[model samples]
Target: MLVLLPPSETKAPGGDGDPLDLAALSWPELTDVRAGLVEALVELAGDLPAARAALGLSPTQDDEVARNAELLGAPTMPALARYTGVLYDALDVRSLTRAQRARADRRLAVGSALFGVVRATDRIPAYRLSAGSALPGRPTLRALWRPTLGPLLAAVDELVVDLRSSAYAALAPVPGAVTLDVLCERPDGTRVVVSHSNKAHKGRVARLLATTTGEPGDVVRLRALLRRAGFHVEHPGGTALTLVVPADWATR
Candidate 1:
């Protein structure tokens, strides 16, 4: 099974691995587009004010732009190790056993604006670019990615679990992939879509899915696996599952 994860805005800086090699990344077909974006970003970085404006950064986030400037020369690390945030924090990949980490490397692929999609083991450098950002002299990133990325993702043979946030998902959509939603159940039986803690729940679910020996080929098996992992999973509709948490889930 393949799990598509969203890339985090905040990434762990520096790495021990060699600099990123586009030819060595998972999708060689995306190299041209990747090279294009890298050139655009590198050029933009020469003008910090323009780069900052293009990346939607404030004064404090200038470091992010600097990171972009050094994207080509910076040391790299596995994509899974590079990303960080509430979701990744919950994933806690650093704590996984060797076998589990191997499984994660095989099953996970992160949606990226600059690289298209990177496998868990793909080497990447610390850089700042959001799927929503419009680089100078380029069409929308969605436009740039959709032509190549969509076909590539749509061709995946495994049951794909798409957990990307809307922006990244907009870049490339896996046809018929099961999308998950985390909801909060109130005492009165009404359910509200989880906002703050949703990433954490998705992260946990991803960790469970990643570590398991079972391969869930469809929504049914996927639901079963999540339930087995102690999550309150419900099939709400077509190709979608809702993981319900208590209303006070965040506090807990």
Candidate 2:
């Protein structure tokens, strides 16, 4: 089973791995799109002020523009280790067992604005690009990615558990992919969609699914697997499930 994760705006900078290599990345069909974006970004980096404006950055974020300038020659790190945010902080890949980490590498892939989708083990450099950003002399990122990404995801022969945020998910709609939603349950038996803690809950779900020996390739197996991992999961028809968490948990 493949688990699709969203990329974080905040990433861990610097790495010991070699520079980015398009041929070595997964989903080879996306190489052309990735290459085009990389070239556009590299060129955009030529004018720091213009690049910062195009990327919607404030004056304090000048370092991010510098990072973009070094995209090709910068050191790289595994995608799993590169991102840091509410979700990634919760997953804490560095704390996983060796076996669990190995399983994570095999089952996880992150949806990126810069590289399309990168496997957990794929090596990538530090770069600044938001899924919503518009580069100069190019179409919107969604337009560029939609054509190729949808077909590539649809062809995958695995039960895909999509955990990407709405922005990244808009780039490619995976056919038959099951999406997981995080909800907070109140004391009065009411449930509301979680906001701030949504990413944290999804991260925990990803870690649980990644470490487990069970292979859930369908809704039935997926629900069962999450239940066994101690989640209050509910299938709300179609290809989506809701994991109900305690209201206190979200508040915390």
Candidate 3:
């Protein structure tokens, strides 16, 4: 099974691995596109104002632009370790057992704007880019990625659990991939879509799937597995699963 995760805006810096190598990444077919995007970012970084406007960053985030400027020569780290935020914090990869870490390396992949996607163990440098960012003189990221990434994801034979946000998911949607929705059930019998705390829940779900001995090939088994793990899972048909949390535990 392969679990697709969204890339985080915040990343850990100063890796011990060698500089970026497009060929060494998981999907060799994406090397050309990755290289193009990387080059575009580097050029954009030369103009700090344009980079800040394009990336929706403030003056305080100048360091992010600097990171992009050094993308090509920056040190690299595992994709899993490079990403940090609410989701990665909840995944807490640092605490996993050695064997669990190996399983995570195999089962998890993160959706990226610059790289398309990277396996958990893929060594990558920290770079500033987002799915919505529009690089000058380049096609829209969705336009650039969908044709290549869609086919690749569609061709995956194993079960795919997509936990990407709408922005990243639109870049390359996996056909028949099981998606999850988080909701908060209020005492009034009404359920509201979760927003703030959603990533934490998804991170926990990804962790459970990554470490489990059982492999769920389809939605049925996947639902059962999550249910057994104490999640309040609901199947609303199709390839979607809804995880309900009590309103009291919900974040606005």
lDDT of each: 0.91, 0.91, 0.93
Q: Show pairs that collide, candidate 1.
A: none
Of models 1 and 2, which has the larger TM-score?
1
What is the C-alpha lDDT profile of model 2 across 1-252, one tens digit per residue?
999999998889999998989989998989999999998888998888889878999989988988988999999999999999889988889999999999999999999988889999999998999989989889999999989998889889999999999999999889899999999988998989876779999999999988888888799889998898799999989889999999899954
What does candidate 1's lDDT look like per residue over 1-252, in tens digits? 999999999999889999879999998999999999998998999998889888999989999988988989999999999999889988899999999999999999899999999999999999999988978888999999999999999999889999999899999888899999888889999988755678988899889988999998899988998998899999977899989999889643
Candidate 2 Cα misplacement greater than 4 A, ranges: none
Task: Give one clash count per candidate, in the order shown.
Answer: 0, 0, 0
Flag the better candidate by lDDT, 1 or 3: 3
Best by lDDT: 3
For candidate 3, write residues 103-177 as lDDT tens digits: 999999999999999999999999999999998778999999998999999999999999999999999999899
Give candidate 1's error at residue 239 in angstroms. Answer: 0.8
lDDT of candidate 3? Answer: 0.93
lDDT of model number 2: 0.91
- Residue 182 Cα positional deviation in candidate 3, in Å, after optimal superposition: 0.4
